[model samples]
Target: MFDRFKERTPVRDSLTFLEPNPMRILILLFITIATYAFAKEKMFGNGSLPAFLKHFDTNSDDLIDEEERQAIRDLRAKLREKRRTSIDLDQDGEISENEVSMARAALREQIEQRRLQKFSSIAGEDDLISREEYTTIPGVRNLPDFIFDAVWRRLDTDESGYISPEEFLSRLLKH
Candidate 1:
């Protein structure tokens, strides 16, 4: 219509405003946030057994042998002694994947509680996962917090919240 009217050309949209794709903008924002979070996250807890075998148990092995188990047991003893010394950094005694996870979870809980306690009243998942919760797990009958702590620590090697493939090898093979 403007062309037919012989009017002077108007500026194109880009020439007037810096409008970008809204969806793309949102996706970029989300990716930025996710990358930051991933970076901030403690990169450990590779508890998957398959991944462990992939790295240590050479020859594409699927099972752990006695010798392999002994090596793991030795590693655990070393790490335990190291924890007793200064390597643990946290000084809680004992070193394993789960112990690290629990400590971090506990820290996060404490930080959140401190922030929220000023206004609200509720507990985190850890606080809710009480002694009874541990006992409720099949084969973990009547286990106390100390036992749970030990088990959790052993499973958590890389120190991320969840256990990993290597952690399974370390804990089960060592035992």
Candidate 2:
């Protein structure tokens, strides 16, 4: 009985169940590579430099000359005053810990609301954003294909070729 049981199957045939799915392997590999590319882009890529120059470089020379530097300083001072006024809930010109906490909570709510609005705007009536729709997002159309694709893959966690509002909001909030 033991000999009969052991005699028939080939090793390769028996182990076929253990073979990896090519599609699954490919997806895993893609996710790993895309994650690495996204991280590298965030760390070593232009970051906020372009936006900074665009806002402060009034002359459009791509360089922050002394005048622009002074403008930035003035803007920072104005922003600081604005923030102080907002945070000092009692109008006492000083922000208490309670006021700080309240202001922080309000800011968080505002950010969440803005993100929801963005998701609604992008998703449109279909309530789903395809890769094409994603490219239409502000600043996304200008990205290199590789970087854009990596970001898309990272956001489309379900690999459904579309981004659901949950995915969009969660991914953005995480970062």
Candidate 3:
């Protein structure tokens, strides 16, 4: 009878101990957080898409072409690496969820600022970007000559071959 009672005590103690294990709890927390993050990314496609669109729509046409997509991917990778290196407070090689969120937010802000600067420069004094004005931008000038005129032409709605500030903002910022 004493042996059986001792066995019962050990079994109950083991069960109680397992329930509050710190390592087990940590593993569970990590799994839950990771699952949530993966699902969120899959559903949302980069957290905030307005930021992505603003950055990737090089011609302000509200469409991301193959080249533009590749460019954006490259830019995103660079920005992520830069921010991770700077923001990883723990010095762990891996960035935490909070750190990644912070990096993404900063990246979004940078993209927005760059867009505003480029818009102001491209708009010039007239507040509208003429086809000629668009081509004058350094970035536009660097694009392949064949693709350059084509992209600008596509963005010039109404077949007017000119882009108004309203059109530019609407297309780029609409998301």
Candidate 4:
């Protein structure tokens, strides 16, 4: 038995037999990366026109009429005033460079704190925001579910059926 075992030749060369096909491995990697890149582009590319129109077209018309345009202008004015008030740290009418810097820091901190608070309230014990839970957000509650579903999809980048704190905060902060 021992003699027979010793006499047997090696089953091919170890290096050749164990080596993976480099071309196949490279092709697989390329395909995976290309698929991921294409998906990301499709999800985030210039597909926001529908959402924009839905938000501004208050009368449910596809086109934004003069009245709708004026509403948008008014909203913008209100937002500008709010931002100006926040930036003016000293409660003065004018914003100085120092005040701007201070306001920037303060705003960042406040935003972070508020985001965490909101996420905590929305996510609750599960620590994940489902579609229903997402809709419950203050400003979001007013929007129709169909309209906001697009926004939810974009925010849920992983497509995991729920929004994590990181995803919620990062996406909201971007806008």
* Top TM-score hit: 2
List TM-scores for all candidates, in order: 0.23, 0.49, 0.37, 0.41
Candidate 1 TM-score to native: 0.23
For each candidate in the order shown, give its overall lDDT on alpha carbons. 0.55, 0.82, 0.73, 0.80
RMSD of each: 25.1, 19.8, 18.2, 21.4
Candidate 1 worst ten-residue window by lDDT: 118-127
Cα error, candidate 2, residue 155 (Å): 0.6
Residue-level error in angstroms, candidate 1, position 78: 1.1
Q: Please provide, for model 4 over 1-175, each residue's C-alpha lDDT reduced to its tens digit, 9 standing for 90 to 100.
A: 5786545366544445456887568767977886676665447665433454478887775677899889977997898799889888788799999988998889899989998898999899999999889878788988877779889888898999999989988898888
Mind giving the per-residue lDDT tens digits that candidate 1 earns over 76-153?
689757644543455666566766676677776776556444212222343323334434557767567688778866
Off by over 4 Å in 3: 1-94, 139-146, 157-160, 164-175
lDDT by residue (44-140, candidate 3, tens digit) is: 5653334425667778766678999899669868986886689896888977999878878888779777876788887887777887788787788
Q: For candidate 2, write residues 101-174 as lDDT tens digits.
A: 99989999899889888888988999899988887888999999999989999899999998998898889889
lDDT of 3 at 131: 71
Runs in model 1 lying further than 4 Å from the true structure: 1-49, 87-175
